[model samples]
Target: MRRLPMSLLRVLWVATAMFASGSALAASCAWPDWDHFRQNTVSADGRVIDASTPEQVTVSEGQAYALFFALVANDRATFDRLLNWTQNNLAQGDLTQHLPAWHWGRREAKPGDTTPSWGVLDSNPASDADIWIAYTLLEAGRLWHERSYTALGTVLARSIVAKETAMLPGLGRTVLPGPVGFHPQDDAWRLNPSYVPLQVMHHLASALPEQPEWKAMLDSSAKLVTGTAPHGYSPDWVIYRSGKGFGPDEATKAESAYNAIRVYLWAGMLAADAPGRAAALDAFRPLADFVAAHGFPPERVDTQTGTPGSNAGNAGFSVAVAPYLAALGRSDLAQAQVQRSRSLATQSPLGYYSQVLVLFGLGYLDGLYRFDADGAVVPAWTSTCPAPR
Candidate 1:
């Protein structure tokens, strides 16, 4: 080929270099929330620690969430590490055989022993965490082409159905908080709304179409969510007694607080075409109105009385409600919440639950991830660049 003019050659070289830099930047996109969480929350060995607790606890919920954030960020090595830690420490060395224990922490010193031990603090499994872990694994399998993960996830999901679910008199198939303690009486079954995220339930159902119970659970979850929040505010816990229907949980006195906040977040992040999306949004509209009028969500609300708590919710609460407000067509209010959350984030660090809320709400709003109508995760990395090898 004939040599180009010197100036033309120089221009072409600069354009090519810039294009390469842009491509690299796109390929290595950073999610600031995920980065912060990984740095502050996750250990080198993949344990997600909450140092504030006496046990220096590692909750199954934290591990499950880290697995999800890892997949979203396309950090496969980190995902594997987290999963290994969960399987070895929480699941008794095999997730396929045992649901991960809910808590791993320091044991209290015995009467004669000078030191305490560190191990599974509570062997009872948390169903919500189990569901999240299974859901994330299934999605990771699809998104990353990991058939092992898909197999492991399938086993766990089936195990959850067999162990953690009960067919109530009115509800077809409902997830208990765990394998035990939820069914205190023959006639009564206590349930938690936060534990019944429809998106994850639908995703399980969609991923495992051969399992009929997943579909039934999805429909029952909708009924549970919509039915329990009769006054537009979800309670942290409710008791469903045969013939009596849903009632206030004596443990919580029917207050909507920390756990119930996730109910709003889950409902808000649901795809537009999700089943029962309309009823869920309408059932929870008062929350949007409350935030709009008060400039902040209440720290607590009485589901039965429709009373707001005196104090504003925590910093994470601001971001947690952003998606809900936006879904309700209150973009102005949503923007306000987003600004508040960011401002608080600059001031100080929040607790684990708050941080998780911030991640879910802001990450979804910022287009880092989304859920499809059938509940498959749509992490931005999948389309923004090629999958990380």
Candidate 2:
């Protein structure tokens, strides 16, 4: 049965490859920095979202690669364009084997390519890319009422979640395969245990709650992530199946802060609504505090010495702190964190992560929803956990 599905998926991939050929189009606008971007495009508030003309810029193949900007700036038009582009381009590949990794340029690049590669499926699927793209596509579908995107997005999310989890052998977090699995660059035969999927699962649960299986997956994911952490310092990398810990790797450890922050913050947020919210929140608090003090996290930590080791820069990590702070109801702290992150990001020229942080920070600052000064949820999105009226 698995083989049959894979074969069918492969055929679909080949068929889609026909249209996948091409370099990326330019972004319609010139968002040199967050400030300039905000001035020209986004209003201080949430109601007025603007997009730079497509003539101004072109997005890459990956859903999130460009969609990040769209989401942060709250530019529905550009976001829609990028999402459509992802559905049309990246989502064309094999449903079973090598999924669509997004391409960054006119020529869709895969991981390890000189240029920024399409984040779509690479030789093998990277869990983060798969989940992020799926999440974004679903959001796009909901925002735009695009049935095709919604359907495809749901399929993508399900396919990746099922395929990857099935390959694993026990009750554990879904780790990115080290060898020919998801990200081959890191460990050849290990699981790149990451926190990104937790976020993905949360979104999935909310997006597709009717499906008992989806809910089960989310429950499984929450258990695995929150359960596996040692004092909430969830090691960035874990050897596959064997359950051995592998710290961060060279490919993108500097971004550890960026990724880890999501795990902690999302875990904390979800715990407030999860049935086992108390324990999860307890675990996340320590990790969050550690990050706040360290300023950075390593891809691989010296377990013996408890020291940090990572290869990426401060850009990714810095940008992540703001949201985490805000989520914890420390808006003042969140703003402070955002300022520091923005400063570090600015020093690194133009990168997607920093741009995203600035835009999202601005969004939070603008009081997009009904968040208070402390970033508390006065009456935000309702959780499965009941809130007092």
Candidate 3:
């Protein structure tokens, strides 16, 4: 009789083992399915990261956006590899240095004179990087449930704002490399209007509403860029000392126009009062109408006639229009525009800009359908763009 009880125990143990094995097997098979999903939606062929092209330093800004896409897509393997590669290869990838200068293509920093000064990195430590890194780290923390990642995001965001305010005339004393006698208006300290990380602040405000600074930053930024300034009414212009400023040219304006639409959308949703919401929408109308009338803006505008300064395709710039159009109750327009933009993006040789367009297009398209209404975009979808084919 005692032996019979032991036999029953053994049978139960075996059954439990079999169940566990089967469950593990199911999980093991999940990758190919995920790859299949990515292939059909994100990538035409789902095996590589970034369409298997090398990252270009001069165009590192696009690369950073792609990194975020990878993180959001829940491709942990690729994400980890990218992080490792960035750390080893890029100057800003050095997470240990909270304020490293963002180097463009090559992983290592090099001595040189470049015009962009902030093509990828503005002011040594740029607001664009701050905003992007903050959101990326925040998303990473949420996905993995790790406090460290969130902490990194929080610190980076705080640092970004601090850096910006410090650079305000007599406030910020720090200076970066460039030519001697180079003025603040020069490449070294020249404020890249497009580099203002207002969207990050917008996102942070919602994520941590308790922090009043986030909202304050957003309000102040809106005023500074679009609000009545001492110089004149500007729409997100680059501010310099001596009260000199340059409005977003065609290229910068195109980027800002799309960004502005998104920021307003976010602000309207998070607004505590009708006046605040109304103001945001009112501010967006002119910008939206301008874009609708003219195609996605040219790279640089003459700043006088709002005419294209150079005859060039906006490259990845057009991808942003899709989501904004969709948000404004123009779904059909958004889809058509996305298709046009994606077709243009695909024509690029290296697939760097084109892949980003594909990802953004997918996200915008998926988002429009998910929300079905602008007011409900938040809970409707989070940004997990399909991988590039």
Candidate 4:
């Protein structure tokens, strides 16, 4: 047992210190849950399948969400795979030229086909999913310094404005659910409040200032979210008449259910300094109070009557409302919801949609990312790994 030379000892010490620093850096940037989500829900070819259905359909929404989660996790490989699969399978091989079809996967093609076929089930584009994809690509471009991502995001954003939005008589320019079917009548158009998250619009406006419609969309969305929910709850869909303004969509019976739940989640996740933060919170205050009183969100609510169905919201709902509750300064209530979410996640695993809500809500609450005043993403990575000059 001989003592090492002084120079050798100093070199070993430096190497050990460097190793520790590198390990810490890696840990700080890791997002293991996202990896788990990819393993469980996404396929090798990048299709995100919702296994709850027997048909195992892959939706544009699923792909969009995976892309966002991948970006957040800083997994460029997964991000590229997800984007490529979406463009090839859903958007006819080019995202810039085509809005990805909403639904694709296995389904019976004809009345008597023995073997089910795999392809695009519906050619319609869901604006919500489209926005998320575009936002992720744009932010990825900025964060990762990838010109290709930025270019694709710019084209997709412009395409969304062109195809998915329309000029409502009194509402100004508004985002329709898609390019078609939303406007069943000449003077009336259907809109989904959940389809346009204010934060996403803000990001788009900041990313694409030349596109005036993005700012108009932000203004109109704030009006719609606050004006439509007279009873402090958002409806899944609503109709706007040329002169009448906002009203419940007859088809949905004014129910605030799955789609509407995201309204509170998005409102809560907004940066404290984000534009219209105060008004958006004020508009959604009743929901915060409801969760505080009830210990969980209602599975369904009558938007006109403020009456909630008996069933309690699942873990996903608890997670979605947690950020909103915290935003309203009810940290205790928010913590309660967080605990409830943990318990629920333990009892039953989250499905695709619930997982998305949890990721958005809890990620913000955990300080993973924040939207700036202008709506661009401020990811944790910026602090960990600054861009090159």
lDDT of 4 by residue, 1-389 (tens): 99999999997887675443322233235555566788988999899999988779999998998898787766777889999999999999989899999999897769888888898989999999999999998888877777888899999999999999998877788988999899988988988888888888888877788998998998898888878998899998888889889888889889999999998888887888888888888987778778878899998988888788999989889988888889899999999998998898998888888887877877777766777777777766556642221
Q: Please list the Cα RMSD from the true structure of every candidate, rounded to 1 decimal place.
A: 5.6, 14.2, 9.0, 5.6
What candidate 4 gets wrong by more than 4 Å, as runs, is 1-28, 109-115, 384-389
Higher-scoring candidate on TM-score, 1 or 3: 1
Q: Write the per-residue lDDT of candidate 3 for residues 1-389, one digit (tens) a residue.
A: 34568889997887675444222112111223234324532322222234343433433244355446555344545555545544443444565455434544323334784532312333254455445656676766764556777776777566655554433343233221121222444332333333433444456666766555666655545444343222211233333443443333333442333233224334323323322444444544543465576665333433334344444335445554565556566676566666667577567542444445445445545531122121112211133333333
Cα deviation of 58, candidate 4, in Å: 1.2
- In the range 1-389, model 1's lDDT, one tens digit per residue, is 99999999997887675444322224334687788888898999899999778789999999998899888877877899999999999988999999999999899888898778889988999999999999999988887777898999999999999999999987788899999899999999999989988899988988898888999999888888888886789999999999888999988889999989998899899898887788888988888888979899899989998898899988888888899888888899999998998888788878888888988998888888899999999888656743322
**Which has the better lDDT: candidate 3, or candidate 4?**
4
Write one digit per residue (lDDT tens) for candidate 2, span 1-389. 33668889997776564323210121122234433654444333211121332222223322453454454333556555555554455546343333554232233445788964323223344566666666666765654446766787778776765655533344433534312455453323333334344544655766776544555665555555565455455545443333443333444432234445445434433323445445555654553465566644333443223445554335545444455555566666656655666676567653444454444444434433222222122211121212221
Candidates 1 and 3 compared by lDDT, better number: 1
Give the runs in model 1 whose Cα sits over 4 Å from its true position: 1-28, 111-115, 385-389
TM-score of each: 0.91, 0.59, 0.59, 0.90
lDDT of 1: 0.87
lDDT of 2: 0.46
